[model samples]
Structure formats: C-alpha cells, structure tokens
Target: MKRKKNNKTGLYMLGGVVFIYIGLFLFDSAKALQAVEEAFGVLKMVLPIVLVVFFLMGLVNITIDKEKISRHFGKESGMKGWFYAISAGVLSHGPAYVWYPFLQNLREHGAKDSLVFAFLYARSIKIPWIPLMVSYFGLSFTVFFSLYIVVASLLQGLVVEAFSKAKR
Candidate 1:
C-alpha cells in the first residue's frame, strides 16, 4: 500500500525559499548574492569536519557490539559506566543531531539515565578544540575551564538521574 506523503515540511521549506527570494528582490540583488556566496563558503569549510565525524560514527556503529554496549552502559553498570560515558562524550565529534541515533540506541539497550546525561553534557568539551582554546585563552584558563566542564558534566548527570528517579 502506498503511504500518503507529508506535505507540511515541504510546504514550510517552499515558503522559506519563497521568503528568501522575495527579500532578495526587495533588497539589493548584489548583496543577497554576496551573502549567499559567503554562506556557501562557510559551509564548504565545515563540510569536511562534518563528513569526518559521520565517517567515524559509521565506524563505531559497525565495530561496537550492541551487547557490549549494554554490558558497559546498562543501568547496573555503576561508576565505571559513568566513566565510559563521560570519556566517550568528551571524545565525541560532530553536531549534536549526529549523536542522537547512537544515544537512542544506547537507551534502548538499557543504558542508565545518569550515564546518558553525563555523555551528553561532557560533549561540551571538544578535545580537538583544546589546543585552540589554550592558544586563545592561555593554558591556565583553558585547563581550568576544561576541568570545570568535566566536574559540571558529572554533576549534571547526577542531577538528571535524581530527577528521573523522582519522576518514576
């Protein structure tokens, strides 16, 4: 059986494009084109980083066993589980949306709420940006900021776990 198509999203996208074109025509055409070119330039710069992150994600999906994930991240996994989650989060790359599916899979496989929160929160610290941060903000400031984020991530996880428990 053929399923009916959802037109809402398509309509919204069409409306957005229409509005952009209208705005372009109403304003300076040359400026609008320039803006578009600049936006594409930024996208070109970011595309490689995004692609690499997805590639690594694919590798992880293929090599990591579901049962092992459950064993390490399950509700009964304890502090060690939190450690693993936090470390993974710190090392995780790409946009937040890219990690959603993996996180959902972990949740389905019995991962604890606290560990999940820890992972999500710890993503605030991008390891690859550390050198840049140090260069821009001084090593001492960067070190402290990173340490603070690590502690805050753990605390955030605990708070989320408490709230989740309370809800249950």
Candidate 2:
C-alpha cells in the first residue's frame, strides 16, 4: 500500500511537469522548444551514467548475497565497514544523486546509517581530479586535503550514527 502510494505520487509529479511544459509550449513555442532541447541535452549526458549505475546495481542484486552486505556494512562491521564504505565512495563516479537508490537498497538490506553517511561524504574525494588538484594546490596540500576529507567523512558518519541512535 505504501509503495503504491509512492508510485502514484511520482506519477502525479511527472504529470505536473508535463502540464507545465504544455502550458509553456502554448504560451511561447520557441522558448518551449529551447527548454525541451536543454532538458534533452541534460538527459543525454546523464543517461549513460544512469544506465551504468543501474546495470551495476542489477549485477550486485543477482551476484551478491544480501547477507554479505549486511555482514560487511551492518552495525557490527566496525572499522572494516568504514573501509568498505570509504573505498566504495571513492571509487564511485558520476553525480552523487545517482547513487542514492543504490545506497538506499544497501540500507534496506541492513547497512548501517553511519556507513551510508560515510559513503556519501567520502564521494567528495574525486580520484580523477587528483592530478589537477595537485597541479594547482601542490602535492602536499592535495594529500593533506584528501586525508582531511577522509577524516571528515568518519566524523560525519559518527554524528549520523549518534542521531540515529537517539531517534531509536
């Protein structure tokens, strides 16, 4: 029942967007076409990344056992869990929003809130940007900044863990 309600809500939102677009088209066709073209341009850039993330998610669902996820990312996972979360976050590419669903899936399977927060926070460290960062900021500053980010990720995770516990 709850899932159905969510689906309905999503559909309604999409409908609202469509309606607005229709109104835009009626008012000014030129602007509407430009808006649509811009929308499609964004979609074209995002589609491949979205497809890859979904494909990886499907592979995880089929090949990896839920129990394993729980074991590695659950409350009892300790430092090992932090390692996994940070590693996954650092390795993950594309927009941070793109990983929300995948992270939600992990959470549903018993991953801890702390781990999730850590993963999201660690996404700040972009491996591909390291070279550019070093060139502009120097290797020492880059290294220190990266280390600071990791520490900050851990701190964020711990804060989230405390809040979750308080709520419980």
Question: How close is every model to the real structure, measured as TM-score?
Answer: 0.68, 0.80
Clashes (N, CA, C under 3 Å) per candidate = 0, 0
Residue pairs clashing, model 1 = none
What does each candidate score in C-alpha RMSD? 5.4, 3.2
List model 2 lDDT by residue over 46-75, tens digit each: 788889888877877888777888789987
**Reference-based lDDT, each prediction:** 0.78, 0.87
Cα displacement (angstroms), candidate 1, residue 73, comes to 1.9
- Candidate 1 residues 59-160, lDDT tens each? 657877667766798756788898898999999767665676557656655677678788888898888998999899999998888899889889988898
Clashes of 1: 0
